[model samples]
Target: MKPALESSPGNPLAHLPFYYLDNFHRVLDWIGDRYADLLDGEEQAFLAGFPALPQPSRALFVRMVMRKGQLFRASKLQYDEIGCPRAAAAPLADAGWVVADPAVTLDELFDLLQKPEICRAFALPAGLKAARKDAQLEALRAAHDGARPFSGWFDGDAAYRIVAKPLCDRLRLIFFGNYHQDWTEFVLSDLGVYRFEKVEFADAARGFRTRRDIDEYLQLHACRERFGNGEHPADVLHDVPPPGTDNEWLKSRRDKLLFQLGQQFEKLRDWAGAHAVYRECGYPGARARAIRVLEKDERYGPAWELLQHALREPESEAERQHLLRMAPRLARHLGHPRTAAGRLAPPRRLDLALPQPDGDWWVEGVVRDHLCRDDAPVFYVENALINSLFGLLCWDAVFAAIPGAFFHPFHHGPADLHSADFHRRRADRFAACLAQLDDGSYVDTIRHNLVAKYGISSPFVYWNALDEDLLELALHCIPPAHLKHAFLRILQDVKANRAGFPDLIQFWPAERRYAMIEVKGPGDRLQDNQLRWIDYCARHDMPVTVCYLQWTQQ
Candidate 1:
């Protein structure tokens, strides 16, 4: 005898016989009642028939009903459309049941439906199934050039219907050649979703078509071949000319290509080759243009040569000015300034001078005073030496004028007094001066001093210092004028003696054989000669320092 049903609803069908007819009937009824809203009319009828059916038939019938409902929903159609009268009365009768909750708003759930297990369970209609199968076969045929006997099976009305539908363009392309004029025309004409129709066909037939008509057309019209042979059919016309006369665009493209080639040659450091190409283009302003490009590339030698040739020709004033401007830069590149040795006799003796605390006190005052009293201009005669000494001495004094200044002198020995001690001591003094003076008053004082002393209308002071570790750093800070002066000194020394100077006198420690240093106050930078000297010292294993002044908060 069967046991009485339990009151608990743990599992309503648990107590039912595992394979008994009565048990299967109860299970089916439980399912229908629990998911009444989910069941279609046919599924409900099948469940209701469970109690009367034989044990063997009940399980199979329930499975068939559930499977049919799933198939009806997945096909995006109602059971009525597929000839199932009972399923036609379901809750999802119009739109069909969404296997996963159709109303579920989460992206995760939507993604879950795309999984193989879920997608497999969701059955499509027979017609869609056949069409999808045909698409897969078409893709395979396009991918592999094999001639299978079953190929003809897809050739009739079924093939056209499947291919004609707005399916994936990639799949469609496999069915059509890249240059299929009809497909190309269709894709290009569409201003909407079907715009990719040709692209899809091209992508599918890419690499398969050997002798594409599109390529032939481009070749015949002197148009650049845009697509590679194995490229997709959709991509064939990607860079093709529009459907009209082609010379203008083609010519423009050619010119652009040549221009780009010239740029590429310039990039490769082939300035000559690039210049030649630019000349070949016959641009009216090609000569000046080529020279500019060469100059930018630091092809100074070639640029200078070209400029000389241009100057020899009878050019307009504008052209002459252009050449003149270029001349100075080229002159610099070629080290054109005639040195003292080249233009003037060497001095009787070289003088080493010490920096004085007072701006008016010259290092060798007696000698300077005597020369100043003479009819000759001593200032002009010793201008180079005076400038050098003044730069060294004023570095610290100028730095001290700035508040919170501290000097980091890059040198092998003790920090230069010009930068080190002066920077530390003068900073507070300068700040005090600045604090006492109003902004306008300070400006007026600077202006008056500039005009009275330097004979300049404007006076602005900027200084910086460099430490040994930061030599490269300090060199960058020096003004171009100062740098030029320093380089001139180095050049002067080199011209005087071919082996290079014994050591940069300004930075060299009197006691050490291989020590070099340069000191600058706040805002000051190393001169060019100083930089060259530092490089020379560095190459020769001499210890070097470039010290800069920094302002420390008191």
Candidate 2:
């Protein structure tokens, strides 16, 4: 079997394995059909001329473009897994794409792919001689121009040509792993196809339904000479196909796409077109976009009216909070007298007593020490053990239930469902995930994460945070319903509520009774989110105690 090149960072060309190479080559072919009009006369000539060449020759040129290197070994073509191999080197040589050198051999190719220190250990056995160099390879390395040692197309001194759209398209796909912003911007900007600032569109709303819809539509349309010149997505979006479903998730996608389209036009200083797109797609966030457009146009009255509407019913509490904070500034902009700021209603404090005077670290220790003699055994768990560690433990189950929950913007966690209503959309799946915590499967999931996923490096195993004793205590004492409720509560706002769980948990192993204790040192107060969680626990009849630490004078 070939060496695994999946995560080989040292050799950037490692991704040119048979599997990825196949799709990349195909996308390249599509690029010709997709963007032929964007090509200059010379590039069009290349496209017309490419298919006339032998398949082997095409393969070799494609490999050269894929490798993005001047020098390559002929033996690399011998790999049976690839489309073209050693038997097909003649076409590439005749075409002058490679200056295949005899010095570069299969041994050298393998050595290049392997680390320097380990190459010797994996070196080819003796008695195998490298095949003779083909004419293309020899001619390339031998070409000389302008008094240089070697100067061919591959030479650094050779006149640079604008890369054909298909080749550039292929390269972009290979590098970014998707044809999104990188490919779109590169093919349009680098190809000199669309000078965005000068480009104008007649029917900006005819062809696009979503961002990807606009991108693919433009990519396909912009290369045809008739449609290629100064095409506007805002013009053709109306002609886009109706969506298969009118669900909220799909609606949100259209909303986001419309917002993005507006932003792009605004960036181009096409305020009218931008405003039209925003109004056409008046989703939840679109009003905010409309306000900005009005403000940009110096229509303060309309902007203020739109701003008030946006503030009245934001998509989320967070958005409402943001709008509330932005209100005074918008009022000032419109020359309104400053309104007195209202104070927040203070949080009702929960009065719970700790056994002794303690500091931050001592609070948990003191709680544990007090609970040691109780009928229930107590454990002081760090924040991570309760939330992050537990989160990882149950990740697989939750992922199975609500796959979209894993979709994080940072690419930090996991999942990639592109819907604004992700949490709401996956409510059933989240409930399924909660079911896992409610059952006895929590032990299996935790063990799987620790032993199978992290092995020795698991924080639960390595950091002495989660032990067999605590696990046993939890299994014996913590009710599955309570655990399920806790998990469900956190899932409501995973990012915000995963932490702030009680520091100490006391459990009666025999009676299957457990209680959570949030330890607070002097001057410490419960955060709003934490208070919300506390209120949830109280309503749900889950045992929770707020242990305030009154420090003793030394």
Candidate 3:
């Protein structure tokens, strides 16, 4: 007889069977009832015939199916660890599902768990550890059939071969509420190629028939492989039909794939392969990639030629910047060819002084004092003030809705922005939530989030000293027209732009004016993301400046 379900309604595991095999039948019955409409004709037929068999026969089938592997020690199903009566697995032996093997022993279980090297570590009887491994296994099997606590031991163990693995996996999922992650690891390991690593476009080319299919496939496989993986993309260009498939979306992906291929080749020091890949990439940065590869290989002639070609039609700011930076170095190698454009001058450094025995906080105070006084606008060298302010202001809309944003289990930040579909998936939810609120709501929400959720211990509220003044000033500085867009941009790429705001913000409540100042101390430089933010702010007519600081002898 099967183990009875508990009577209590409150227990989550109340309805579960005590025996693993009986639970398997329960899962099948449940799935058949719930998902019969969704299953195909073949699946429906299998479910229709499952229940009529005797209890032992049904239990045997379910156990083999749910257990993942076909083999098991017969005793596992028959008796509990403390010698309790469970289902007799005799029906499995009577049928072909389980084949008896007298040779099977505890040593086989050790091997199955991949612990054969530490077999002696197990607390077997005193002499067992010293005996030969084969002798120990044989002795243990004999002891099992003899009158020990391990009762009902047959001459040998029973083994199972899963004839229908996929069906069994579905049964396990329905019964246990999870597929066995370890049971089918070897069979399912290949999913890693399609999952946590980028699939070569060539490998996926045949599988993807439509343009959108290719795009989605590439997105799912965006996890880049480590450097020096000896794998190359198949020439997917010819495989993907370019004739009728003039879709711009497909073309764009093809271009991107080629560019990534070029980058991989460049990293591997395959200069010629990289150059070939880049030539066909058609991306703005492709020429730079090829040029870098050539330059690394000390092939200045080819590198200079590529640079000149790229200069004629520089596509993006990044391309232009690279050309400008590399031009002089490459020119030196090419015997300093004379051109109408004059030699590039070295960058000029600003002359400034710090107070004697400079600390970062001291410099911040000096700059703040230098910039502000009893004036219309208040100047604050607020290091983390703006970021903290934003964090507080956007707390309810962005952080509250997302679990683990503030209350993470391991105290780590949310998943990587570029990695996974994290930012892309959450961006819309974040944007829509943030857009619904007005200026007053932002202020009130910040206060609520600070006092209620974060309280006194919140890192974001550490600069609560300036919170009221900063909030009032920010109300003036943040443009009403672009508030949603600005906040959305910040949330959309939060991982990249969250922590890197400018150091100083001068606000004039009377004039309704403000300017962001990126204070660069001696040897400090603007990062790429900072430059991007500055450009973004400039385009929106938000006042921002980069201040270069230099120390002089006082």
Candidate 4:
């Protein structure tokens, strides 16, 4: 019999006792409507058979699938509704949805049993009785290289292995378009912990359009897991197939896995292996990373050749910074004339030597307190204020319901936010949003969104860091030209430029002026990204300052 949603009286969305089962059913129904073409024989069979099981049985299976692992102890699973765990599991086991007698290795066995139970099961000596659980397992592990059933280990013991976990995980992937989010998203939404923007999705929209995309996603996930499990990079790379040409999202996943594999090789000092991985990798920073590896390998000639090509058409300011730093050294090593990549002049500076505050105060907070006056106040707004302003201003373009941009309802932002074609795809929408800046309509647009879309999940907006007073102060003090300049730079490279803003911003209400400050403690040095941002602000003649602080002797 089909299970029903058991919500508390008078509250359809709250107090759902069987919310997981309801969520699972929603996924099945969604797949039946939207992704029926992508389901294979196994998935088709599982969906067809799932509803015919008893309600308690379906609930029990979902409990196992949503849980951490496949193996569940029948004695421990005591749901109030499922009176007896063993009885509920019987239907699942009989239907072959769960393994009745699965092999349990020493590692698995160690995790499942207490020390006393393990000792009693394995008949360890009396002296080993006082040892720790790990000690006892290690003592008996050598004798048992083989796996045995739970009943074989401890008489009258019962455990179950959900054989449908792989299929369930695939269903999750299909619903969410990624494995990072699980059924907990439903719970969080129901509880009002998160509120996503409503975007219209066409009936044709599916996370995976073809069956091959689904298979490739699974393969990429496996390769990532293998690499993370400390498997050899070369072995993982051998299994990682080439990225899908059609799906930028899947290609992004593949690129990240390949980039990580390359970094692993670099960590092992496998220069040749690292170069091989980076040469074919199209992930951001791959080219600069490959050049660094070539330099490490002392291949100055090839490094210089590739470095020249990169400098001609630098991917982002980050890559340009790396290539510029490399140019002088590489040119010097080649015994050629010095090459000069234009560098920006340093911005204005502010120096302070204040007694360090007590009670675990951070550097930014200390500086903020020191700088605030009655007429002017400083906020420790590290990239939040500016990014939040931009997020509010461009909400339409960011959440535009383009194909593949948003495949699911729970997305914090677009799936292809970092894809190469992200800007190209939404050029018109973003252009319309940014056009308001020139015509003096941006203030109204941003103010409207701040009130309308507040507390909604966003990739850039930090709701906690912004209040109406602070945003109003920024809008009044900061000029539209400055906002336009900052937003333009962000649009150039959203992934890289979104961060690395000044640590603190001081606003003057009466004077209608503001200055961004990058604070540095005694030993803290500026990172490359920070230097790039400071230089960008200087280049645009924006009011910015780098503050150097030294602890005073009390």
Predicted structure with the largest lDDT when compared to the true one: 4
Compute each candidate's TM-score over C-alphas.
0.20, 0.42, 0.43, 0.94
Would you give me the overall lDDT of model 2?
0.50
Against the true structure, candidate 1 has what lDDT?
A: 0.35
* Residue 197's lDDT in candidate 4: 94
| lDDT of model number 3 | 0.51
Clashes of 1: 36
lDDT tens digits, residues 1-554, model 3?
Answer: 21222233353443444344444455567556544544555556667765655565565565555453555555455523213212344444444334444243454444432223324334566666667766756766654543211112332334333344455554433323222232222112222211111112221112223434433433323322211254554343324333234333334445666777777777667888888878777654787888888888889998999899888877544566677678777888789774343222222233456554545565555666667755545455343555555556654333332421221111112222222234554666655556544534665665565555443233233443555566666766655444554565565445454545666777776666777777777777777556656666666666777767677667
Model 2 bad stretches (over 4 Å): 1-66, 69-88, 91-289, 292-301, 304-313, 328-390, 393-398, 401-415, 435-449, 452-554
Candidate 1 per-residue C-alpha lDDT over 440-467 given as tens digits, one digit per residue, 9 for 90 to 100: 2433443343333231111111112212
RMSD of each: 30.2, 14.9, 12.7, 3.3
**Model 4: how far is 28 from its true place, Å?**
1.7
**Cα misplacement distance, residue 470 of candidate 2 (Å):** 11
At residue 368, give the lDDT of candidate 2.
Answer: 70
User: Residues 1-554, candidate 2, lDDT per residue (tens digit)?
Assistant: 11333343464434444434344345446545444444455545555666676655565555555443444445444554345444455555554433443233333333333233222332323322232233222332333222221121112121111133344554353223233434233223322333222111122211122344434433433322232254465554544334443333334445555666677788888877788878877454566667677777877777778778876766543344445555676677799988543223332333445545546556568757766655777778746445644454454433432322221111123222334344565566556655666566766766565545442222112334666677667756777677777666555555455656667788876778888877777788876555556666777777778777664445
- lDDT for every model? 0.35, 0.50, 0.51, 0.87
Best by TM-score: 4
Answer with 1 or 4, whichever has the higher lDDT. Answer: 4
